[model samples]
Target: MKEKLFRWVVKHRKPIIAFYAVAALVCLFLRQFVGVNYDITSYLPDEAASTVALNTMGDEFEGDIPNCRVMVPNVSIAQALKYKDKIKKVDGVEEVLWLDDAADIDQPLATQDKDTVETYYKKNNALFTVTVNSEKEIEATDAIRDIVGDEGAITGSAMSNALATTSTEQQISIITVAVIAIIFVILVITTTSWAEPILVLLGLGVSVFINWGTNLIFGEISFVTNSAGSILQVAIALDFSVFLLHRFNEERGRHGSVAEDMVQSCCLSSVAVFSSGCTVCIGFIALAAMQFKIGPDLGLALAKGIAISLVSVFTFVPSMFVQFDGFVQKSQHRPFVPPLGKFARLVLKVCIPAAVVILAVVYPARVASTSSDITYYYGTSHIFGSDTRLGQDMDKVKEVFGNSDTYVVLVPRGEVSEEQALSNELKALPEVKSIQSYVDVASPYIPTGMAEKDTLDLVEGEHHSRLVLTVTAPYEGPSTFKLVKKIRCIADKHYPGKAMLAGEGVSTTDLKDTITVDKGKVDLIAVVAVFAVLLLATKSLSLPIILVLVIETSIWINFAAPLYTGMHEFFLAYLIVSSIQLGVAVDYGILIADRYREDRVTMHKREALLETMEACTIPVLTSGSVLLISGFLIHAISSHGVLKQIGWFLGVGVSISLVAVLFALPGFLYVLDGLIGKTTLKAHFLPKDAQDPVSDTTEASAADGSAQ
Candidate 1:
């Protein structure tokens, strides 16, 4: 069936080319409508306490959980109130809370509770919490910034997400251009023909654009998905075209026409490319199964991309090569990087030692990889690395007022005395900066006519009264999560099942809980799925073990680096890298193993490995190196901490994969060749004599029958 499809591709080269051309153009046009989601909170499950509380609050009340905080220096009570009013009037500002809202600012502020007053006003600086709609984050933040001018700093979800959106868009644009040029240059530097680089990139590029264009169907993707997916698709799937094209060139001398050569080339290279693509897809399938929605968000994008790239390689690549045969022939040049068949001699000397070393470190590397310091939260300050306005503002806010986090508790409106008891207990905690509840700030149990409007409006609600706790939780971490847990306990202790908690602290804590579970599950699923695919692809039990070990060891080595360096890895990057690196890096092992399986039909295990290295090294390393260079390039240019770490880890990850695949994999295959052959069915190469270059014979069948 696949052979027939390859023939169809060859016969209808022009139509295939035309379809891709038109599809690429159409997808590009549609790609613009695909939205990018910057809110990490949106990825949280609906059942999370924060999610439920948030949903309930949105439905029941006009007020929202504060999304931003603005601090202005050298402001008096009246001036601060004026600033509050101005911020409140901003188009997107639904609510802005300052000291005036809770206290009678018309009187001397010193008469009010010290902690309560100081939480909002300290060192002649006034801080205000601004609630803005998620959709208008950027516009609203911009308006808020304008109102504050140069003397103020704003930090919170609104501004953080705004920066996340804008910065990711800009960074992605720059990264795509830079990485493409880098890949092209590397391809040209290594390939035997100048046009080979162009054709390869063009095939991969069109697939990438088409993948992005197709994102319209999903409506939106996370910022990380769009940021990482496009480039990764190119890097991971690059070898498909290279392997097919090289095979095409090899077959060209025998065939009468370019179409015939391409058809045969597709036949020979199909299983290799398909196997590699399948393993990569398996990795993504595991990621898509993650409890965290962002896993599926990115997983589906990447999986779809690899699928599209596989199709492009089999169809568009063959068609374009045939169409541009004359140009390829015209531009053909001597290879700058000679075939690395000689490197097999060097690898033979070290393969044992390398494998031994890797085996010895396997347990430690695995342990270290799991033990590396990781952060679950990505605040704007952290993502921006304290290098931009958003980051700097966040730092300034933290410096001036310390890490003030707010938690909103909603309870039955009539339970004012219980709320007061809860508020008093919360106030007794040293870290609690202030508490604004109806019992403290308003005349509890009074008729509507007796209560002050501003104070009553701030805490009172029609169905559920709001209690705002300003605490020194320091944004998000183990300590903040601990505080959140303690606070939830306190709320429940006082109000029983009725008290609900919602805020950044709660959300971040929930994120921590959800991802902690997801991380291990994602890894397990990816390994098992990829291992299953390998077992089927190679048809050898031992070979699957060897290939998966090489791939996973390289990943372990990559992830374990941060532990040695004392660099805190982002938890998201950890999950993303685990899935992506496993999915993509396993290709190296599969490519080598697949080619080895093919070559062993007529050759001994040692000779098969040498030949395998000779044939597979360039494409394998070319693919891995492309990813390495791209990862490092992104690391260098990306300002986001997680993105930078991802790039670095992936770059280092591929570097490890290159060495392991090129050197250690040969060792493993040679050492375990007997087990491979014994566990396998009598192997027969696919394709006719035209596709099978080894020239089959009774000797070939005898050699194939042995454990390779």
Candidate 2:
């Protein structure tokens, strides 16, 4: 079946190339329909208390989240009120809540509680909560900016997401170009042919487009997925093409023509590439099982991308190679990277001691990785610096508000007495800076009927009453999470089974809990799935265990370095890097181990090991370096701290994996060869011979000639 398929592909090479070109165009056209969602809160599970509260509040009170906040410094209540009225007239504005919205501005200021009044109207500044549909936030924010002019500040989730989306959209083309250029240069240096690098990129570049275009099927993807997915697809696509090219070149010496060599190489290369691709897909597929919607959003996209790249490599890349046969051969040169025989020998000598040191320190690294800072998840760090309007607005609000945390508490309405009691208890808490509620604005002493209907409706909904609790603590500290719990306790005491908390503090707490549960599941699924693939491919229990250990050690070392430096990593990044590194980097071990097994059938253990390293190291290094550089370049170029952190860790992880695959795996295999040969099903290895060098040197020289 494999021979027939390869023969058919070779016979229809031109048509196959044309077919992919058309498919790529169709995918490109579909790209416009791929929507992007920037809201992190949307990633939360629907059953979460915060999510329930938000939906209920939206339905019952028509009080959508005040995702955009406007801060006007040194402005009087009268002027701020006028400004609010003007903002309300904007096209997308739904509701504008200010001090006057809660109480009649016509009434005397002396009648209101000082803290309640100051919450919105301080001595020299006023804050307005402008509620707009998330879809129209950019329009509404632009209109608000025009109204507020240079003095006022605008900062919130709505604006930050809008800014991030806009910034990423503007920079993606440049980043993609930069990545392609970098990979092209690396391929040129490592590969023997200049034309091979271009063909390699062309083949992979089309695959990236197909992956992106197919996102139309998903409707919308998370902001992070769209940002990172393209680069990853490009890198992986290039790796697959490189694998095919290397195999094709090896077959050239024995075959009569380029077309014949490619046809013969297709089946073997497809098996290897497909197996490795499955491991990568498994790694990402585990993410789709996460309760967090972002996991599925990113996981499905990446997994699909890898699948598409694999198909394109098998079908599209081979066609291109045959079409450009003459140019590829004419452009051949000595590979810039030389053999690593001496380095491999030195690394093998220290393998046992290095493995011991790694075992000793891995636990500390695991423990340290668990200590992550959740604060960065809530705030926005602008990529364009503070000189931009978004950055300046963020700074202005932070300066006026200091570091404060706010919570939106929803409780059953119509229990005026219990509600008043809950409000009083919240006010008395040392952590609570202030509280804005119906009881605070319109006292219980005043009959509900006598109060203005509009004013009453603002705080008291049909089924739920809203209390905006301002706390002195910042969003990330222990004090802030503690304060959130304290407020929940008070709500349960006063209105048990009816109260729910929804805000940054509540959302962050949910994220921490949700991710904690999902992390274990993802890890287990990835390990089991990849293990099964390796077991099936190699038919050896011992081989899978040894390979997994080598790759996992690299992951431990990658995360451990951050802990050693006392750097605070984003919690989600730690989980993501762990599974991805294990799945993707394990391929290097598979490549070497597979070759070693093949060579061992004819040669002794030491000779086979040396020959395998000589053949596999450059290809592994080329692919690994591409992956590493792509990540670090993102770190160096992107301004967002979240993206930068993710890039830095991925780059570091891939680099560590390369070291383990090249140095540590060979050492382990050498020492464990006897056990492996005995346990591995259908294993065959030649007897040890003192004259193994003759065959090794001859094979190495022939391999060198072919590369040049």
Candidate 3:
């Protein structure tokens, strides 16, 4: 099958190259038709209580939860009422609720109930819960800004999401350009030909468009997927093209014709690249096992990207190389990396002590990776530039309101007495600062017809009553988890199976719980999956363990570096970086190991190790530097903290992996070659004076081919 693919690629190079070029352009155009969804609640599993309650609230209340909160400082009761009226008049605003919505604003504040007034009016500030039409939130928000002017501040999920969409659209192109420039610089310095890097990037760049165009099948993707997916696809896929081109260059010198050289190189490099790509695919696919849909969304897109990249390298890259054969030959120069036999020995000498020191710090790294101060995890600061008016508005809102969690509870419509009792219980809890229920506005003793219809419907649905509980417990802390558990207990005791809880806090709590377990499962699955691939690729029992250990150690060091800085790391970053770094770094080991296996047949063990390092270091280091630069660029340029942290971890991981692969891997292989020989399915390594059986068999086959 490999030989056939090679033959066909060489035979039909022109058409294949032209088809991919056109297909890439078509995909680029088609991708603009695809949509992106930034609503986090919408991504939750249907069976989750928060998801169900959110859906039910939207159904019963004529819209979803309050999408934006408008803060009006130093406003009179009359002025606040007038502001609410104007907001309601906005085209896409479905509803606006403030102190006046529940009480008569003309009445003295002293006469009104304290709970109702305090809910909307705190100190000299008044707040409005604005429910905007989902499809027109941006337009509605713009209208609100126009009416409120600079004094009024608005912050909420919808506003943040709108900002994120704009921010991502603005920055993705910049990120692409930066990554390409950095990659080009690295390739130019390391490779013999200047055109090689550009050609490789062309294949990867086209593959990114094709991968994104296919997302149209899914209808939409998350904000994270939209932002990070294309860049990551390019970074990972570039390796295959680089590997193939390097092999082709080497083989071209040995073969009589360019076509024959490409065919032989493609057949050998395909098996290598296919195995490595599969390992990465398996690592990404493990993310789908997470119950959290965010993992699955990112995982599926990246996994598909890896598949596209593999196909592109096998088809698109070879065809382009064939077309540019003469130019490529003309463009060749001496590689920048001179032979480093002494450097390889120096690396081996320091390898053991360095490994031992890294092992000592692994525990500290694990602890730092796990510890996070999560109160600010979902802040709106990242939505807009801090220097902008919109950013200032968000800061003002946060300052005035402080960070508080709101939980919406639903229970079967029971005797008004039971609801009144439940509301009292919730209000009495230490963490609960306030509770708004139907009982707040009207007493159960009064007839339903006598109560204001709008006031009655505000907290009462057809079959269920709603209670909005404001809690002081910080998110993702033990207090928050305990508060949630206590509320669930109270609900279960009061209403049995009819009670459900949903809110930002509830959703985040669920996220925390899911990822705590998900981290371990994702790591284990990534290692085992990649291990299986290595085992098949090497046909050696000992090689897989050595390779995995080398990469995992680098990952731990990457994670540990964050502990020195007091900034809290996002929990998802650890799980994702661990799996991804392992998947990515293993390719380096595979490349070196493959070279070592070939070199050992002709050279002594230590001499073979040096030759392997000298041969493999440039490509391995170039790939690492590209990853490192890309990661740091993301860290430096992104407004969102999670993305920045992810980028930092990625950069650190690649740096450490490069060091390990170049230094420790060779040292370990030098010591363990005899054991590797004993366990291998196809042992090829021999001492300096030993005869080679595999080479003899290959020579005999070539002689037979010549005779035929």
Candidate 4:
């Protein structure tokens, strides 16, 4: 069956070549219409618990959705009141609520005692809350910026959207350009012909379009699906093309006819490429097992994309290959010689003593270092910009609001009827900065002698119930946690089954809590899925374990570097670490193992290892170098530190995986060969050659005549 398929490809090469040329042109034009989505909310599952809760809250809030807080500095109560109408007149602004308006008019500042008046109304500074009705229709970021204009600064969770989107787009663009450039350079170096790289790129472009067109046919394309998988496709397709072309050249060098050599090349290279693609597809499919919404989507998209790339390699790549085979053969390119191969040989020569030294020194150093901080995921500029925004906003909020901290407590609807008890308990909490409830708002102007409980009559109505307590902490760190916990305890004691906490701080805490709870399950799923793919691909129990070890080591080393660099962040670590490890490590493992298996058939275990190293090293190193250049280029373009961190970690991880494959895999293979029976190991490494039960001299004569 394989021989027949090979013969067909050879016989119809010209027609196939023409078909591919037409297809490539069609695909090229179709790709321009594809759009990319950058919304973070897109990553969330439609039915996820947090998403559900958020949606429920949104529905309840109705027309009163919360807007991002805005702060202005060096402004007084009078000044704020004076500009209140001006602020309200802003195009997007609905209404501005300030402390001056919130305060009771009956107890005017001049009537209150000095200390009481001072506490109630500061002379110079005032805080205001702006409510925009279009919160749901318009992005909070766009609305906030429109209102604030150039007059004042705004900061909060809303700002994160703009910053994150801009940074992510920039990172993607920079990485894509850099990766392409690096791949082009590497191709030129290896093939020694500028035209070959251009041809490979042309093939890649066609593959990308086909991949897109297929996805479009399926339905709406996912942004993550498109961006993340496109690069992976390009990398895999280019490598496959290089492999096929190289094999074609080798067959020709053996004095075989062009048609025969082309058939042989396709048969040999396609098997390896298809096998590798299957493994990658399995690895990605395994991600579907993850509980997170984005995880499954990422897995499915990547798996599909890889499968498409393999098909493209067989069809589109072959067609292009047939057209360009003559030029490629004439190029006389030198194979890549990895710089690290020589270093590996040097280490092997002094293995015993060097191993002892590494164990003694490096092992201890590894213990002292820890996994990288999540902040490092953002890279440098992102962190600095975020910090600047936080600091500037905090300073302004402090000046205007008299306190930078705020908290919101939710009392159950039933518990709100017992508002007096809840308010008293909430106000008594040690961390309470200030307390406000419907009770404060309902009471008419009261004299100074009025009892405190009587002042709470404002919220006594049955339909309108509940108190909101705002707390200010002495310090930013542990105090916020302590305050929140104390308030929760108070709510539990007074409202027992009903009250809960919900606000900016509470929401942030909830997100963190959810991640912590789900982290282990997600991690386990990812690890198992990746390992299973590796196991099936190598068809060896030990190789899968070694691959996992190499991946883990790369991740650890990549993450730890961020800690030393002091750019680590929790969000960055959670998002990028596993993704980077999964993306680059699997590719490296497949390429190395494929080469090893191909070499094992013709040589002894030791010689096979050496030859595999020589054959695979160039592609592996070139791929790694391209990945690194792309990552660094992203880091350079991104002002966001998290992106820089991702770039750095991903680049480093790829480089380390490359090194591990070259050195660690060979060493481990050597040990495995020593332990496993030589015959089994050799058989495992050998490629599956086509079986020829029948020979036809007539066909051979025709093939030779056609070649001439």
Indicate which candidate wins on TM-score.
Answer: 1
lDDT of 3 at 157: 64
lDDT of 2 by residue, 622-663 (tens): 888888888888777665556667789889998888877887
The whole-model C-alpha lDDT of candidate 1 against the native structure comes to 0.82
TM-score of each: 0.94, 0.91, 0.92, 0.76
**Regions of candidate 4 where Cα sits further than 4 Å from its true position:** 1-53, 63-67, 82-96, 105-127, 131-151, 207-263, 269-272, 278-292, 327-415, 430-437, 443-501, 562-566, 572-575, 676-708
What is the TM-score (0 to 1) of candidate 3? 0.92
Q: Give a tens-digit lDDT track for model 1, residues 1-708.
A: 877988898889999999999999999888899999888878888888889888878877777888899999998877888898899898888998888766777778778878878889999999898889888998999998898998799898888888777877798789889888988888887777888889898899899889989998888999888888898999888978877876776788787777888888898888778988988887887878776788888988898999999989999999998889899889988778866757877787788778887788788889888873633453333677677787788888888788888889888787767877888898888989877877877666776458887767777777888888888877788788789899889989988888899988788888888888888888888888888888887788888888888878888888887777777678888888777788766877887888888887767666677778887777777787888888998898887777888898888887887888788888887787777777767765332233333334645887888957
Using lDDT as the measure, the top candidate is 1
| Deviation in Å, model 4, residue 96 alpha carbon | 4.3
Expressed as tens digits, the lDDT of each residue in 1-708 for candidate 3 is 877878898889899888888888888888988888776656666777777887787666554456677888898877888888999999999888777656776888889777656667878798787878878877888899888887888877667666666776677778879999988888888778878888888888889988888888878887778887787777777778878877887788677788888888998676568887998888899988877777788888899999999998888888888878788768988877776777777876786676665556657655755555322243222435566555677678667665555688888875688888888888888677666677866777876668888777777777777887756554345676778888988988989887888876677666667666777888888889899999999898999998988888788777766566665566656666676788778878888888888788776676677778777777787788888889899888876556667788888888888888887788778878899888887776686467555456668999999999
lDDT of 2: 0.78
Q: After superposition, how far is residue 564 of candidate 4 from its true place, in Å?
A: 4.9
